[model samples]
Target: MGTTGVRTDRLGLLLAQFDQARETAQVRLTGLSDAEYLWEPVDGCWSIRPREEAVTPRAYGPGAWVIDKGAPEIPASEYAEVARQAAGGMSVAKIAEDWSVSVERVEEVLAHTGEPEPDVVPVTTIAWRLGHLHSGFAGQWEWSFGERRREPRLMVDFAPSADLALERFWAELDRWRESLGAVTEEQLDTVGFSQYPYGSDPDDPFISVLFGANLELIHHMAEIAVLRDLWRARFQLPAH
Candidate 1:
């Protein structure tokens, strides 16, 4: 295949993944109510709140941003214990028993089959996640293709409420998506196509940048879907 043909094929595959990611995010957001979109199941979970009500004393870096309540970093000892068990060829059930977690939980982490049961863990709300998706698209597009400027759509600006957040998300995402069509094969092959300073743009090829963008979509969609599941379960909604 010629250079253009190869780049087009590569970009086509990434775009397919991008579409699937967006669909999965949309499905997760469907029927998400305003209350649940802003609900914080754990104290200090990063979520969208009113400008005045978004106070978080425990916040680090950006306050009340997309930071979610997270599992405490697992101890090195625990990681070593898992490694030890695996080296011993212990059964998953045995590993679970030794590690003080459910067999299902162990399997979930090992096989990556399911979301962990959301405990009183810190987590971002649907509104916050949606705002993040929009911001990512806008930020990437601006730096990579459009004029690189200091313009940034902050979470608080667009994510005051669930409805408005969703509206902005679609608008920004559509604009970002449409802009991809203008990227030529030569541009895709060129290194430093994006001068976005926050990431690998300084050294990596444009194709790597595209791959990184796809990774953002896939992982964030999965995370949002898990958060949606947790939100539904928090209210004891029937898992339809």
Candidate 2:
């Protein structure tokens, strides 16, 4: 109908989507054990780990626990094989078959050819997914609604255990929901309303940023649900 009405409708839709996704995730996460939270379905999955056990070049958070991010250290031996595979023109599928690994693993290895940084998406544990959601919400809230000075990577304290992680995750989600609830109709249409520096929030309308955030929550939470399902069914599957 009117500009105000449109903005209100858009905001309502985004909030409903976010709430639905969050509720679904929470339902899936119910009674999640520490073993399931930290379970890595395959080798080389990026995940949360004790500080001393971290293998990634950079780890986030200040607590005893850290989320794995940045370039992983590929062994020199693996690099040598990568070189040989490239030189021989081996198909990714063939390479994976020969190595007894997933095709995604072969692609990830190949992605490290020119750059040392992580360009490939690795499999992640539930802890890692939850950590990402927590940091994203915290960071956006700070830059968009708070002081806009502190980076969440340095400020967020990673939970040391599954129970603590779920607690903090819900808290961050509440903070983000509160911030969203305070936005006015005009603010939704205002470009640069969200000054989140890490993303395009400063250049796009606040509504766009909110939509993107909803998408992030929906997709990542769906992944967490699938991981839970896999964890439950792992014992029933025949050995490969």
Candidate 3:
């Protein structure tokens, strides 16, 4: 086949894969309720909360977003270990004073001290996942292809509700698709065509960047799907 024909075929194949991933992501996000979108089945589950209520443990860490609440003085993960060390000897007042939480909450924590620590991968709300995808596409497009301007975006800018989030997500996908379609054979084959500074793109070919973006979208979409399933089944699990 001719060079033009090969380029067309390659781009076509990539586009098809991208569209399939996009459709799967859309399907995963369909019909989510607000509560479900923000569900936190376990403490420290990263979900969209009001600025005042944002409780993700990493929020307080260095490089956390300005809007994200700082981590509690005593992280939720450490609570179990701390309680175990106390071994039913630590008073609620002492625990609360040390952790900087309400005494009532401390008592509750003490009661559940014997339970295993939550093994979560920093659960994020559906809204957060959707917003993250949208921003990721937008940022990569802007940094790698469009104008090369590093404009920062916040998750809240995507959408406040599931319906709006889906709408915005598809719109960003469409923009990404357009950018993908515009890549010529020369651009794709050229090393360092994508200069996305935050990633390895500066040292990679445009095609590699495209493939990486697909993997990211697909993996994150699957993660969101799993989170939704867990959210739906949150009430069905028997207490340990």
Best by TM-score: 2
Question: Clashing residue pairs in candidate 1, if any?
Answer: 69-122, 69-123
Of the candidates shown, which would achieve the greatest lDDT relative to the real structure? 2
Q: How does model 2 fare in lDDT?
A: 0.81
Instruction: Give per-model CA RMSD.
Output: 10.6, 10.8, 13.1
Each candidate structure's TM-score, on Cα atoms with residue i matched to residue i, is 0.64, 0.75, 0.65
lDDT of 3: 0.67
Tens-digit per-residue lDDT, 1-240, candidate 2: 456664347788788788888898888889999999999999999898989999788777878889998743344456556557656676777566555567887777777655454335679999999899888888888888999889778767887578988998898899899889888889999988877765457756889899989998988888999999899999895879
Q: What lDDT score goes with residue 233 in model 3?
A: 76
Error (Å) of candidate 3 at residue 114 is 33
Clashes per candidate, residues 3 or more apart or on different chains: 2, 0, 2
Instruction: Kindly give the stretch of ten consecutive residues in candidate 1 with the minimal lDDT sum.
Output: 58-67
lDDT tens digits, residue span 156-204, model 3: 3633466766776688789889888888989888877876554446656
Off by over 4 Å in 1: 1-8, 54-122, 153-156, 235-240
- TM-score-wise, the better of 1 and 2 is 2
lDDT of each: 0.63, 0.81, 0.67
Query: Which of the two candidates, 1 or 3, achieves a greater TM-score against the reference?
Result: 3
